[model samples]
Target: MMEPAVCGEPTEPAAPPPLLAQLRAWLAAWLTDERTARELVDYGRVGHYTLALTRWVAIIGQLFTVLFVHFSIGIALPLVPLLAAIAASALVNLVLLWVLGWRARLSERAAAGMFVFDLAQLALLLGLTGGIQNPFVVLLLVPVGIAAGLLGRTFTATVTALGLLVASLLAADPLPLPWFTGGLVFPELYRFAAWAALSTAILLIAVYTYQFAEEARHRAEALAATRLALAREQELAALGGQAAAAAHMLGSPLGTIAVVAKELVNALPADHPLREEANEILDQVHRCREILKTLGPRRAGSEVDRLVRAPLSATLRDIADEFGRAGISTEVRVDSPDGTPEPCLALPPDIRHAIANLVDNAIQFATSRVDILVSSSHERLLVAIRDDGPGFSPDILDWIGEPYLSTRHDRGGLGLGIFIANTLLARTGGKLHFGNTGRGAEVRIEWPAGALERAVEEREHDGGHD
Candidate 1:
């Protein structure tokens, strides 16, 4: 016998749910979660005009079919009910157009509701005509398929389930098929087979359509992100160029100040107060010159020449230095196969930024060391960045450079770094390869000899003409 519960005492906690029940609950929660839906399904916008136009077409088709069957074929359809259903659909479409202007975009819920209405209307028509026995019963898959492409999984599943329910009900008991003689009757097994076929088709079509649409949407979003990242890298490079220009312009003034300060210090007595002030001025001028030196290439030449060209070794070394972290050691090595001098190529900002991004990614993943190797020959140039850490996951290795494909969720990145790097490199006629080299992951980028250089030169020439 159970004892009476006390006011403050807690009752025994309910027994844990059975495994099947728990699984069902989990699935329901996952399907209903709004955040998951938004992330998985990016149904951008459904315009009112588009929905209205499609509805108008469907209405016209339905009208034509009903009129032709009833009058031309002399088959007796429940004309009043059939016409009423079509008119109801038209009226609903009209109301939608009136409330939401033609150009207005629909919210996900509203779009889903419109699809539900379409499914209901189609179901009603099928039930009246002959349910699954009618050839037109196949139309039941249409709304569900469309919804799967444009709506979230929850809404799509709901529509599909609704369609299945309607089909089942109609198959069990529906109006006889119209005929010139009496109403045509179908076998129970035939009706059941038709229902099964339609249900299977709806599920299959919905799944396939959703998968294709989702993949296309993901690709589009990833491309947009890649473009944005490239634009940002270009901006930063432009800012660096501006800094070089500033450094160039200020060099003469700073030198003049240093010279004036030195003269003042030499003219005055060693212990004079003005001499100390002059010495301070000289020190500041020296400091300013040092700061400017770090801002741009140290080579003595026109600003454009200094900023536009760099040896492959120097570029790799600069990137390694920039990405060096306290725990990681970055090394850059350049090899010339024929014992020739290092190639001094036109260094476009896009290329520099792409190299830098790859180096940074390597550093982020490396346990202790990142190595950048650049090898050039008469035929091709190759750059490989390798990291001594856990290599690429086997599952995603084949998809390494694709956008938003990353195994580094621990690093809190959207996985666009590699994609952006790959895209920028490709734009400059480079091909990238990904692999693991026993110790860690390696990304190899290759370009035909002189390809990048010629590309850059042509771009500069075009810019000059522009």
Candidate 2:
């Protein structure tokens, strides 16, 4: 498999470079690549709106040229004035496109300010010619859509007010589209009123639609976070139960080695190299005994995974949101057996604790971003947390969630989080898995529900007999 790029290991040292080397390096990296193109998909709306605005500008320019000639034949103002105005309109449109480009690439705050510039330019254009009568005044939709899509509720409302104020001021000031089509196209009292009513309706709908879409997006995100939390709990439980069993299964074999080593020690000659090696073997047995002693008092061979249960959406969302508020860009998406959020029953806090630990683990290493995805089959709820950070070492990946295996030497090898995480999950009846995910490592919590239910049932059966 390809090595992960962002493993959480301490960064490798970079070679020194000459001055202006930084600038050149920056420029070279900025040269667009596949990733650049992929990122640009987010700017598709800006590209689309640019084209729409460009088309309007062209159409309005042609209309202006024709109107200017007709006005020159009879009006008091010089043909120069109208032509100059037309030139100015075209120049402003060019600037609008430029600003639009900037808005697409910039942050939300910057985009809001740029949108103000776009609005003012269009409002100015409406004032120069005819406000409501300027057929192209309907071009207001572009900026309105921009506001609705990019601006927050307050900023959007502000933009709407400015647009309406500008439109009303221009509408009352009758500027005509220079009619070169031989007949003057002018709106009467009722006609202009109707146009304003219809356009206003359209603009309001766009704003409302934007708000609806944003709300839906937030709800979906919340749902997803909930699912991931649930999965993390389930997966952790499963991991723990399996590890405990594996630890238990080793006991018999380890005991046999201890017994055989005792026999060999008795058979070896005194002070011999062979006897010294047998003594070493006996020490190894003692170490093995020490290791297994950590398993505490287990009912030997009983199901440890029996207590784990899959978590619900509400549980997962809280985990993601809690991390997100701490400046980690956390996102959660939840998929149940039906691939939707249905009412889930209450689950234990152990599952919640196991998942929060996973999120906290990622928050520690993530540069700025974290994602949690939750899905479950009939058997297990799979919770995966992926981060934009350095990932695990190969050895760590192989044994992560296993008791005593750790990657944290930086903080003095405090790895009990994984041990506890694994133990908690196993106790609850799930599994905790850790590995590198491309630029970061992913931790998966898998809960096998049937095994847990079976274990619970077996306990109940034994209780009844007792």
Candidate 3:
């Protein structure tokens, strides 16, 4: 057996790798891509939000700053400048809130936009007070943190560099706010340098942490998808296995039915109704033969699965032809053959017989058309059959796939059509699922290219005319 996808098989195209190493490599690649980089730009929107909140914080902070200065014997006119900064900051905050809501649907772009908005808000707050000396200048950490949360490594580096540059510039040319001391000595300059270094480290660390969390989320989703596919593949193999075995065993009984029916046909007097019945018996036996014909090829695992690829149109036509002979009007919409080379190994004729019986059942209730739809998505092929007849009651869903569940007006059907389809999928690592769980009835089969090999001989052969 091949290694499962999660286990990383040699032939699996999208194999899962060791998650830690995969995360690191993916992050490196993400940061380098221009499109991913552009998504980082949306982080500025977070800045936009912080600015609004910052505006209110500064307003409240200014009120306290003024009260403190007024009550203190030495504290002075610093209140005037700080209050003005607070008011200007509030206006910017409101505008940014508008921008974020207005563009929430921008997704990644929104994240980048918020980042820039936060940065500008921080810069404005620093400028309003005595540059780096402003107490609330701790606000600068907000934008860098937002950037880290939403962007990959490269964008994060850009944010860190921009933050350091802004902080350094503010520390060097302390804004001429009223809060600044009339003169500064070495002690104040040294304190100012320390503040700048601390702010830069805070921003860089924030962004890096956020990037790690996002990468972890992506890995989790990818693992979940792989698990689902593997489960489905296992189901198909089981169905195919049961189908091949049943078809092989049924050969003897079906052959006996034919032999007995032929013997009766000759023994009956010319006008006897019993003779008609035996002829009918002969026809039913032939249907059983066709079923066996469709099930003859049964390959296991990847090497055998591809043996059953059929033209979507061809499969539909073959199905329609069988039902049409039974007085059913089936219409098929076949998408043009996909150009990919086919795998070999066609299904035995009995599998088609089982499918035909399903169409025949639908015809019993259908007023007009029976629709057969075939579609493929890469390595998977899907065939869906639907009838607009009165739908089956939910009570029948459980019984439908069982081998001998029959409720027919004609004593002919054994209700084993769906059973064989389900069985065939089990043998090939494919699946058959009932659809429209509510009112209408639909049966769908999903098979991998590898599993098809058991049912078909080659991938590129021209399918017979309908």
Clash numbers, per candidate: 0, 37, 79
lDDT of 3 at 48: 29
| Ten-residue stretch with the least lDDT total in model 2 | 300-309
Model 3, position 421: C-alpha lDDT score: 56
Predicted candidate 2 versus true structure: per-residue lDDT over 303-345, tens digit per residue: 3322222345566777777756455788777777755343243
Q: Model 1 scores what on Cα lDDT? A: 0.80
Which runs of model 3 end up more than 4 angstroms from their true locations? 1-74, 77-85, 96-103, 134-136, 175-192, 199-203, 231-466
lDDT by candidate, in order shown: 0.80, 0.61, 0.59
Lowest lDDT block of 10, candidate 3:
457-466
Q: Model 1: how far is 149 from its true place, Å?
A: 3.6
- The positional error of residue 145 in candidate 3, measured at the CA in angstroms, is 1.4
| Model 1 alpha-carbon drift over 4 Å, by segment | 1-45, 67-74, 78-84, 152-169, 172-175, 180-182, 215-314, 320-329, 334-346, 366-369, 377-379, 388-390, 393-398, 403-416, 450-466
Q: Could you tell me the TM-score of candidate 2?
A: 0.44
| The candidate that achieves the highest TM-score relative to the unseen native structure | 1
Candidate 1 vs 3: which has more TM-score: 1
Task: Report the lDDT tens digits of candidate 1 across residue range 152-218.
Answer: 7778788888888888888888778887886888998898888888888888998898888767776
